[model samples]
Target: MSDDLLKRTRAVLPSWLAIYYDEPIEIERGEGRHVWTADGTRYLDFFGGILTTMTAHALPEVTKAVAEQAGKIIHSSTLYLNRPMVELAELIAGVSEIPDPKVFLTTSGTEANDAALLLASSLRRSNQVLALRNSYHGRSFSTIAITGNRSWSPTSLSPFQTYYVHGGQRYRSPFAGLSDGEFIAACVADLREVLDQSGGDVAAFIAEPIQGVGGFTHGPDGLLGAFAEVLRERGILMIADEVQTGWGRTGEHFWGWQHHGFVPDIVTFAKGVGNGLSMGGVIARAEIMDSLGANSISTFGGSPLTAAGALANLRYLLEHDLQANAARQGPVLFEGLRKVGSPIVGDVRGKGLMIGVELVRPGSTDARSADAARGGGPGEPAPEIAAAVLEATKRRGLLVGKGGLHGNVLRIAPPLTLTADEAAEGLAALVAALEECTP
Candidate 1:
């Protein structure tokens, strides 16, 4: 059944756009942490659709809310006020630490980020913005501009971003030789330089509390606290891109920025907010959001249907204690990977469920043998070990995903509903895959 479906998909879909994997399984449905192909084969899904389905696939409450809202109204123009939209705003405010959080809803993370950039620029009356290197905001023009990835080719990048700092690569940080306090001081000094050199032209400084796409690197508490202070002193808005790290995925904290011990002027969120429904948002401190004079708006930004789905998802997450589950399971999963002791595993770091295991080339016999224990390479592994692990896991009734600037990091983000037994199973599969690809 899966083969037949795959054949049909290939025949109908554009070949150039299709990313063909070795095993072309046609996924038909999903429930909890499991996804089934048309052939009825089950695969434990640790990827969670790249952290977009936190409450798990087809959650009853979310599905019911979406169904009921569809029956009522699929969409209503934002020109008119909508009840779900209003209620969702209230829900967001309750969870947010911002005094009077004002929400600007969007259909996806990119839109939320775009809105954030616009809000920052308008609020500060400046075009210069500072961003951290190796961050992934979104694929929109403005968001991409602020994104510091070297691979990004954002069209029309203003000649004017003040200076992008590199953050969260503590092992090889730009401030590697400095003490924690000195490192914090260095980061703050750099930003102060940028702001001073640009003569306070920066409107905002955007960063991810935890660098999700950059291999789940968590920011040091003092670093973030000091950076926030610098931006605050300069009167620049701080935009925290919590698209991947927010909405209970991080476990211990509801908001990733809260982990840093400061509140952002604007926090952009998406991914898990609607449990796979198309909903994203920006929560701003009241004064920051009110800076604009009501001329800025999105047509489908706050549809009643999407808002209803968000509301239900939020309730389900809190009531079911999914955040607590993420917090609980996250440590277990990390320890399990650590015990694998695969030499190839250079780093195993993340908070909550969002995690990554970096693969680098071995240097010495000890390093090689250590990686040999887990099956990793020194430089870019000749055969793409991570890709092999992805396929091997898929073949063994599990689904996983990969990411990183070099696409070598194994991204292990599962639904908050994932059980300890399920996580153990995933870790076993990962270890087995690592062994299978041992170079």
Candidate 2:
């Protein structure tokens, strides 16, 4: 059955649209933190549909709200008075830390970021932009221009005259050995040098508090705050692409950027708000959000059905204190992964529910070859190893994900409601899988 669906899907879908595993699993249905394939095989979900199922799969409140809203209306365009939209916006604005916040709803994170790019370029009146060295904002042509990773961007052309800066990945940095303060200073000095060469203040300095597609790695805690101070001096707007790092997924803060001392001029979000529904939005200070004078409306952005579902999901997340759950459960997950003692697990880091486990070349640690392996190096990122481990885990009734610049990292972002027992079970399966692929 799965094979038939895969064949049919390939017949219709674009080749560039990637799927997980060697043979794709046809997800038929989900409840809570587990999903069943077409073959009736159930697996405990670790990726949470790429972290889209924030609270959990098929959450009752979200489904009920969507059903209720759909029973009345699906969409009425952006021209009408959208009560659900307004309510959700108000809820977001209240929590958004930006001063005098305003919300502009969109259909996806990509569109939300597109809207943010439009706002920044218009308000600052310059097409020059600054982005982190390993950041990914979105897939749109405009957002892709600011993305630093070449593998994802696909094209050299850009809507903005973009410059990539350092400080996204501290692990791979030349400055990796420096202290946090010195590292921040070094990055700031580099920024100055880059700006001096450009001879202009960039329109905006866009970044992710924690880079998602760049192996889920991030720099020292205050790196962005340091950059923010410099960008602010030149009146450069700061755009926080919080698509994956928002909604208390990072645990310590409600928003990822909040881990630092700065508040961004614009924040874009998506992929979890509606608990499976398509929804996203941009939040910013009132001044920046309202800068453009021309008329604009998203025909399908703020659908009442989506808004209702998102609002209910938001309520459930807040009421359940899922952030607290993440904070508590995150350590358990981390510790278990560490104790797996697999030489493939090189580094495990991230905050809250968003964690990244970097897999390195196996046999790097050995009794006789220990020195040789250490001298031979961090071993090229082992994507094939990661792929094998992913399949092995699935065979064990556990589902996980792989990512990174070389696609060698395991991204374990379960629902915020993850339990200690579930985490332990997943960890055990992960260890078994890692061992299975160790050779």
Candidate 3:
């Protein structure tokens, strides 16, 4: 059944659409922490479609809201007064963390980011933008222009003059050997150098608190906080791309930017907030959000159905304290991986439910065995091994995810509603997969 569907998908879908594993399995339905394939085989879902199925699959609150709203009305455009839209905007503004914030709803993360870019550039009156190296923004033309990953960026043509900066992901950074303070200083100096060389008319510095599609990678907690200070003095706006890092996905911080101790001028979000409904938004300080008096409205941006459903999801997430659940379950899964303790696992890092284990080719420089673990050549990215492990994990009734600039990181982001038992089960499968697949 999957094979037939895959054939049909390739025949009709765009060539660039990516599928997972050796054979792509169709997810027919989902429960708390699992999904059943078209053939009725269940797999423990770890990635949650790149962290979109945030709370849980088929959450009753969200489903009920959607069904009830749809029966009354779906979309009535933005022309008339929409109570649900206004109510949701009010809720988001209260939690946005920006002082005097205003919200604009969109249909996707790409659109939210596109709006942010346009807002910043229009206010600053410059096309020069700063983005962190190894960051993945979005696939649209404008967002792709700012994305630092060459693999995900499909085109060279861009509307903005984008400059790539360091310190987004520090594991493979040039300052890998430096201490945290030194690394922050070095990255700050680099940002200054870029501004100096570019003649200093930069519009904004946009970055992800955790680079998502680039893999679940980030520098030290205070890295962005330091950068924000430097940019603030220069009158440069900061945009936090919180599409993946928002909604308390990163444990210990309600927003990923909070881990760094600073609030961004603009924050863009999608995925998870809607709990699979097509909804996204940008929140900005009113002064910046209203910079241009040019009136604009998104026809289907805050439709009644998506708004009602997303509101229910948000309420359920907060009332049930899903963020606290993520904080509790995250460490359990990480400890399990540590006990796996395979040489193929280079690093296990992330917060809350979002985690990643970078893979390296086994026997690379023998840093751990006969030779000492110091001053050895870094292991090459083992993408082939990652692919093998994905297949192995899938066969064991576990569905994790693979990513990274070099395609060597296994990204694990289960629903925030994951239980301790489910975490143990997923980790057990992951360890077995590693043991069977590691060379």
RMSD of each: 4.1, 2.9, 2.5
1-439, model 3: which lDDT tens digit per residue? 7888999999999999989977788899998888998889999999888888999999999999999999999999888889888989998998888999999998989999999999999999999999999998888999999999989988899999999989988667777668989998999999889988888899999999998988799988889999999899889999999999998888798899999989899999999999889999999999998997598888999899999989999989889998899999999988888778788987788888889888888767424322234655446678899999999999999998888998999999999999988998898999999999776
- Candidate 1's C-alpha runs over 4 A off are 1-20, 154-156, 159-162, 176-179, 364-383
Best by lDDT: 3
Between prediction 1 and prediction 2, the one with superior lDDT is: 2
- Please write out the lDDT profile of model 2 over residues 311-357, one tens digit for every residue: 99998999998888888988888787778777788778788888898
| Ten-residue stretch with the least lDDT total in model 1 | 363-372
For residues 42-71, what per-residue lDDT tens digits would candidate 1 score against the true structure? 989888777888888888888888899999
| Per-residue lDDT of 13 in model 2 | 93
Clashing pairs in 3: none
Residue 386 miss distance in model 2 (angstroms):
0.7
Write the candidate numbers in order of decreasing lDDT. Answer: 3, 2, 1
lDDT of all predictions: 0.78, 0.86, 0.89
lDDT: worst 10-residue window of model 2: 365-374
Error of 1 at 408 (Å): 0.8
**Cα TM-score per model:** 0.90, 0.96, 0.97
